[model samples]
Target: MRFLLVEDNAELADAVVQRLGLDGHAVDHAGTLAAAEDCLAVAEYDLILLDVMLPDGDGRDFLSRHRDHLETPVIVLTARSQISDRVGALDQGADDYITKPFDFSELEARCRAVLRRRGGAAKNEITLGEAVFDPMAGTLRHGAQVLDLRNRELRLLEVFARAQGQILSKGQLLDRLFSMDADVTENAIEVYVGRLRKKLDGVGVRIETVRGLGYRMDT
Candidate 1:
């Protein structure tokens, strides 16, 4: 998942970013409301961890104004623990609220719960074609049959699956496949694609490559 963390506290932002990364998410940090608005205008995020006490303005106001247009889920993180505060945030369009000094585990669970709801699942699973992907466990299933995929293949399939029918460039695929510190070249993506394709064979969906463009799944 991709998350935009809007926090003014430098230390807290760094810690949250690291924790979210370890939990297999790509996070973008914005310390001020202006910066966050700029990020939102340009990039799409799966979730937003919005801090009410932003440097430039109150995050609640931002949510109230922008929530209608933003399909992404927002979880308000704040120091306030009052019942009114939680109710107010929800009224202003927050999906979930977490008080400060919270257990990271609980935050992670909240994230999964919110995302599960967003994906329209009773549990934490996403379906595409015949594949039912469990993002939490990183597993894919087709009814009773499960495909045993390697780490790289799984990540690649994940990108394609989430993209739905959108065409993806090799550059986009590379970004999803390797972290900044990982030693990998763009050409190596094709190797992973080849392996993923073989495993996906006869799965009722196929990954189609557009000669000059990139790859996308077709049913």
Candidate 2:
């Protein structure tokens, strides 16, 4: 997925862009409302992470401006956590709202929630054999027992569990595991895959490597 991040703060934009990029999404940064409008004019984006305060104009006004034509999901980011602010943003066509100083995990979860709604996916948990994986919550359950997993493991497993039957190449796995800021090599994926495979040992699942192709999860 490609995202347009409409933010004025350079630090926040860098952090969010790097995070989204690590999730294998292409992100474009626009520091002002005009830059955002210009990017929206020519390019297509799956999502927009918008800051309510901008140098040129209010982001909520921007939402109202493209209310009729913009079908992509917009999640508002604002320092103001007032009820009226949240209500106004939603009323103006924002898909979801996030307050400032939010947990990055929550932001990721909210993004998935909006995307799921857009794709008409009603279920939040995915089942692979006896193991149940919740991408939003970042949890895995095997029967009544819940497995503790690292952040990287959870991210990697989510990718496979979401696409249980499809094969993902090493390049794809690398994309899922690390981004531009992540100074990791292709071999890093092997280490994670090995660890994840062991973690799911008795969980009634296996990740198989296809020669000359990639990897697939068998449930």
Candidate 3:
């Protein structure tokens, strides 16, 4: 998963970025609403961890303004413990809300919960033929064996699995695998795809190249 963390607290932002990175998710930090807007203009994210009290403006107001066109889920992170604050965030289209000084584990669980709900995953595990993907644990299993996939390879597979059966262009894959801050090219996606294909060979899930268009996964 890719995330945009809109926060001004450097320490909290750094900690969130590191924790999510450890789970194989790419994250971009935006210390202010202006920076967050710039990041949003350049890339797409699976989720947004937004801090209410940004350096420049309120995050809830930002959410209110963009929620109409933004399909990505947003989880409001704030120090406000009032019921009105939580209600206001939800009314502004926040998918979830987390209080400040919360545990990293809890934040991770909330992220997974929001993603699962948004992705229509009722269960934590997604089974494709004999392969089972645990989005939370970032692991893939085939029958009795666990696949030793590289981080990029696993990320590619996760992207394909989430949007299964839909055609995804190389450009779309590139954005999902690498963050806007990362120095990567469109052709790098092909290299990762090739490697992932070799690993998923006979796993009952097929990655089909759609001629000049892109690729699609079929189970």
**Per-prediction count of colliding residue pairs?**
0, 0, 0
lDDT of 3 at 120: 84
Over 30-103, each residue of candidate 3 has an lDDT whose tens digit, in order, gives 99999999999989899999999987999999999999999999999989999999999999999999999999
Q: lDDT per residue, candidate 1, 66-172, as tens digits? A: 98889999999989999999999999999999999899999989998998898787976667677787776678898798889865576677678768788998878
lDDT of 2 by residue, 75-167 (tens): 999899899999999999999999998888899889999977976779778887888887666789998888977777887887787678899
Best by TM-score: 3
Q: What shift in Å separates residue 12 of candidate 1 from its native position after superposition? A: 2.1
Best by lDDT: 3
Candidate 3 regions with alpha-carbon error over 4 angstroms: none
RMSD, model 1, all Cα superposed?
Answer: 3.3
lDDT of 3 at 96: 100
Instruction: Please say which candidate is ahead in TM-score: 1 or 2.
Output: 1
Q: Rank the candidates by TM-score, best first.
A: 3, 1, 2
**Candidate 1's C-alpha lDDT?**
0.83
C-alpha lDDT (0 to 100) for residue 3 of candidate 3: 95
Candidate 1, TM-score vs. the true structure?
Answer: 0.80
Q: What is the TM-score of each candidate against the true structure?
A: 0.80, 0.67, 0.91
| Candidate 1 clashes between residue pairs 3 or more apart in a chain or in different chains | none
